[model samples]
Target: MSDLYEKLKRFQQNTPVQKPSPPALVPSSSTSKPLPDQLLKIPGIVRGSQVMEKIQQRDDAKKKFLSTLGVNEVTNPAGKYGYREIKISNRELPITKEDIGGLEIQTISRDASLAVFNANDFLFFDTETTGLAGGTGTTPFLIGIGFFDEDGFRVCQYMMRDYDEEAAVLHDLVKQIGRFPALASYNGKCFDAPILQARFLLNRLRFPITDMPHLDLLFAARRFWKKMLPSCSLSTVESRILGRTREEDISGELIPYVYFDFLRGIRIERMRPVLFHNVEDVVSLAMLAAKICRMVRHPENECRHGWEWFGLGCCLAAAGMWERTFFCLEQAVLEPSLSLEEWIAINKFLSLSYKRLARMKEAVDVWQRMIERGEDVFAMIELAKFHEHTEKKYAEALALTERAILQMRNRQNDVMANGPATVMYEELLHRWNRLLEKRKNP
Candidate 1:
């Protein structure tokens, strides 16, 4: 009877609950691609000297930081695991810091919002790591830096060759990177930067660089290509944006194992695909950044009226382009297929912008509509605050705050509830105390 009961409990535990489908990265809508100018053009990214100056500064910092660690070169010549050295380099490889500084980022967009670069300068970089792990233990044995200047976008990879060359590869990359102002990568913000930071920390080397801005194409791609695809991963974006695909590259999960095989002097063939994969990553970033820049610089020529406008608006706001955000939100609002999520976001942003523009009535109207969408937590919180401060409706604010609190409590998602609910809870106690004080005064 115990055995039977145990088997019955196990069966009950195997039941499936209805999973909440995650929010779509970008809602599907009108099938319009961005304008032709928004297509990636790599040559325009590497055009100027500010870019070069920033690069030099960073390179020196990294070199100074890393030299202290004493791991300066890849000391082995015999390929590991019996693997032979693969001659992946061609045309002497752009070896020096100066040579790489001159490549240009071709501006793909003529949109006004993306006019930061002089229609000419840009940087592109990618990395090949020891493994797929996110921890510091997983080092980038090879770091590739590519950029465009006068000549064009060039792909220069730091080939590990074996344990013997990893140090040399990193050192060379540090020097080369010191020549560009802006840097870019597919998923560099999350993966590349952390990996590089870890490698530098491990070696106790001063990473020679500061004041350089990174445009992670992964996040950018998500905003630009969200309408057409479910995801904005490099593989997906590269296919749609660049008209290129990597069917042949090794899966990222298989990469660390492949490096291990390389260390063991076996599976030299696997390295070829990895190299190709990084090449695609570097090239595609150049293309994608160029495209986004175009849309930013030439918003009037915008072909798609969805996430791109919203994205550019955010970018403009970052650059202190309030008018641009205003314009961007204006364009975003015009899109007929704007989802409930996007509509709320636009309204919130527009409300903020209107306040900045001293248009309180417009901002109030925006929040009122949001209040109507009481199911939307953000909207509810926003409207409650609006009522408290702008309308002087303290009671209305309290009611809205109570509703928000109840909604969060019902879901047991208290930890992430909107700020107003928490504020209201605390403030309620304060107000009660004040009432007691008033009665004593009377």
Candidate 2:
């Protein structure tokens, strides 16, 4: 009897459940491709002729779920998932309408389209997925969106109530996001958007999220805070940079298990935190975007920290805004807390910017500062070249070059070991000889 029961249990687990015929408008398992193996592994996953019945049951459950959270399901302009929007009057987020208004239009590497980006046209996008490492097997269960409105900021959340509702969720996302000129997310360029594209292809639906300017804030966050923060994760940026700490939040790693539990008949309350987490991510994207845009547009007033100034300077420098870049670098070098490496980097850009502005005195000052701080051979070489070529002070250049050569020898093979340094040392010798010849002839 025990062996017979074991055989029956194995058979039941392995057997494919019969799917109920769905409504014409609704996607059925037969027409849609099979769910991935990961999704199929959830216990009590809807199957059999009862599939339609379960869907009906899910509708009631979804109603209760949304009611418990005080959010309503929007089905109008149908094919929407559990979509709803909320307006916040006094949200503690950092972005304002004016900040979004001033955001500069930048080119996207992927799309090669350049247009002035309006914050109104940008949909702040984020996704909560069943798996982070994306493949065809993974699913995007929740999509969170935020945007600026006349009143303030509006955030919309679309969630998949069950595995079969993924198509509805995706379709609704496309309908909403496709109309927007661009999508902004923390790391959507590499992760969220691509995974979503994969899910779209797997579902045999048209991938509508494309060709728009994508502002992936992860790159921006790294540029701004990678030096100070231990990690560049959104949560880290939220706490460390944005000054927002999440409480009562569900850990992202456990989110998949929460969805799996819901499939296995767990109470809807368990998934509330997951929904809240997604909402927070979307809101944070908006806040971070506003902060970055402000720093870029008005670094002198907005950027407070030395590292922040340095980061903004690098961005301005890249954009060829030499005057603003110089000002930011000037502020950055005044920051007494800068690390040696940070100090060096800021001074290098500062000097370069000064040179670009034809301010040789300021450029020489930066190089001199670098040398006073430490025995930077690169700074010494730059200053020597400046003296020899710009100021025509050959004797001063010869003295600096001789000091570099003496230090290079005292360091015992330091210059000889580096190919570039060796070449620099030989060049210094040539400069010293040239200066001596000039002195002899004069």
Q: Which candidate has the top score in TM-score?
A: 2
lDDT for predicted candidate 2 compared with the true structure? 0.77
lDDT for each residue of candidate 1 in 1-442, tens digit (9 for 90 to 100): 9999999999889977778998867546756666553443334543344566775665454334333422132333322211111222334332222222211122222233323543134457777787766778777765656655444446665655455444555555566777665666777878888878776776666665445655556766665667657778777777765677677787777788887875554554566677667777776665666566557657777437667787777667765668767878778867888887777778788888787877777777777777676365565566666666677666666666666666656755563476766665565446445434534553
Model 2 per-residue lDDT at 367: 89
User: lDDT tens string, model 2, 198-265?
Assistant: 88898788887767677888887777788878999999889987799888698888898888877755
Return the clash pairs for model 2, or none.
none
Q: Mind sharing the TM-score for model 1?
A: 0.57
lDDT of candidate 1 vs native? Answer: 0.61
Worst 10 residues of 2 by lDDT: 102-111
Q: After superposition, how far is residue 27 of candidate 1 from its true place, in Å?
A: 92
